[model samples]
Target: MIDRFLDRLAALVEPTILALVIILLAWIVLRLTRATIQRAVARALQSERLSAREEAARVRTLTTLAESAVRLTVILLALLTILSIYGVPIGPLLASAGVVGLALGLGAQTLIRDVIAGIFIVLEDQYHVGDVIHVNNVSGSVEALTLRYTALRTLEGAYVIVPNGEIRIVQNLSRDWARAIIDVPLVPEEDVDRIIDILRPLLAALPSDPELGPLVLEPGEVFGVESIGQQQATIRIAVKTRPREQWRVARELRRRILYALREAGISAPYPRTVMIFHPSSPQPPASS
Candidate 1:
């Protein structure tokens, strides 16, 4: 009875131990290959003078690809190893896997497309984490980008997951520099040249201002007067700033311009009203 019990234990334990050993060895080999692949990809991307964000995106893409490949390889090897131990035929298994893979791939074509498109996006640097983008009317800052999909945090703080294939056009708003455009309306009677003259010196001095040295890429300048209304003319000023700083520059410029206008005693124009009387009210009754 003891001999039978020992035999049963051997039958169960030996195969399990052997399978585990093979799995461990396979995992080690896969890890080595994965590391090598990642290093090669990293070196290639580094030669492009990419920024840290770009580098991180590339590394993530490569790591994901490597992991997928390694997992598939390990799974196939483990299956083959176990089947050999059990004396099962592998020719039929390979044929069956081919058919099954084809069916599965067909059913998951959209997913595959999203993954492939996402890879291209990462490699091409279409956008990066922290970039503000407009993808299919879902505007937000990119919180995370992956081969499967992109995660964005909307301006309202909602998290949105967008499939890569569905993104037809990508508008990246935070690339280099953006324009800070403001239109100031002045009384038509005010001298245009005087306003321009006053603003020119201020704009010229802007580049050297310590407060604006880093934020302002270029000095503000009058683009042109857009329109002259009945009481006022709209003056257009444009400033170029580092990406995502346009709004800040605009607000600051507006505040400063208002202060300057007040200091100069320039009164901004206001709406003019015209009054008309009905024929019936044109004549008033004589008072006693």
Candidate 2:
């Protein structure tokens, strides 16, 4: 009985241990690759002349994506290795998988499309995680971008998950520089061209302001009167700013312009108050 047990152990134990070793080695390699990928990403991010927060965020995003891909490959390799150890012919197995994949493709074409689209999106750098984009009619900031889906958080604090394939057009608001636009209302009594001229010099001098130098990319521009109203006309001022700085620039520009207007004694149009008299009122009506 002892001899028989020893023979059985020799036949199975050695190969099982060898297979375990191979799997461990594969895992080690996977970890190394993950580390290397992460380091490369970090280096690339650091070399960029971006803000500290942006650099860190970009590195984090690249690392997460790389890790996710590596993990998926490891899982697939492990499964294939196990199948090989069980004497499954890999060639036949792969051929059968191809057929099965074709069937799945027909059934879930949208899923495949989404995955492909997602790959292009990441590769092209159309938008990244934490970017604010307008996809189709939906506008949100990206929380996460995966191969199959994208996670977004709207301005209203609502979270949305959309399949990548469904995004027909993407308007990335956080790409390079954003525009800060403010419409100032002035009474029709004021000259539009004169108001523009007054603002142009002030706008040109924006880049010279030390406190606001970093946030603004260039000077602002008066885009002309966007609309004319009964009470007042609206003149639009557009200021270009670094990504994510548009809102802040808009607020600051508005404040500065308001102060300038006040200092120049340029008054805004106040709401017109009209008094109405009824037929029964005692007030006499002006007549010829």
Candidate 3:
């Protein structure tokens, strides 16, 4: 009994040690792979003329995907190695895995499609985590992204999850630069030329503002008389601004313009209705 127990213990020791070694090696490989992926992505994007923030986002995105793939592969390889060390036949296991993978692929078509789409999205750099985009008629800022889905935060503080496979015709609003177009509606009786004159100086001085100067790429332009309706005439003003600055600039400009118009004694147009009542003398007399 003692001799038999010793033999069994001796047999188990070698495999156990080998398994631990394999696990350690896998950990080292995972770390190295992650670091390498990061370096490679950073080097690849260096020539793209992107801003530091943009480049860092792209590098982080690419490295995360690459590292995940490498980690999964290493874990599988390590697991197989440990199994084989214990006299487990890996050939049959591999064959069974292939069959199971085929079944899963058929049943999880949507998952596979999403992953493929995600790969393309990352490769193409469609958008990054801070980018405001409109996808499938839902507009929001990207909060997180993964192989299966993307997370967005709407302006109203709603959280949305979108499967990557369903993304089509992405409208990226936070790319490069944006334009703020403001239309000021005035009473039709107001002088158009005079309104333009009033607006021109205010628009020109926007870039000189200390708070808004850095965000303003170019001085605003007043496009006179966009349209003329019965009640009002629309005067258009457009200003070029940095990415994501359009809305802020537009709001501030509108506020200032409103105050300026008020100070100048110019009031905005309002809907007016004239009602005419016809006298029904014969019908009233008949009723009485």
lDDT of each: 0.83, 0.84, 0.90
Q: What is the descending TM-score order?
A: 3, 2, 1
Instruction: Give the per-residue lDDT of model 3 (tens digit) for 173-275.
Output: 8899999999999998998888888899998987889988898999999987899888788999999999889999999999999998999999999999868
Query: Could you tell me the lDDT of residue 199 within candidate 1?
Result: 75
- TM-score for each candidate, following the candidate numbering: 0.74, 0.77, 0.88
Q: What is the model-wide C-alpha lDDT for candidate 1?
A: 0.83
The best candidate by lDDT is 3
Q: Which residue ranges in model 1 land beyond 4 Å of their true spot?
A: 18-42, 51-94, 185-191, 227-233, 266-288
Residue 288 accuracy (lDDT) in model 3: 40
Task: List model 2 lDDT by residue over 175-255, tens digit each.
Answer: 777988899889988988878877898889889888777888998888998999888899999989888888888888888
Comparing 1 with 3 on lDDT, the higher-scoring candidate is: 3
- Candidate 1 lDDT tens digits, 1-288: 999999989887888788888889888988887888888878888888875765775576666666776778888888799877656889898899999999989999999999899888877778877778889889888887878899999989999999998988999877766888899899888988888877777777778988776789888888778899887898899888887777787888888888888888887789988689767656687899
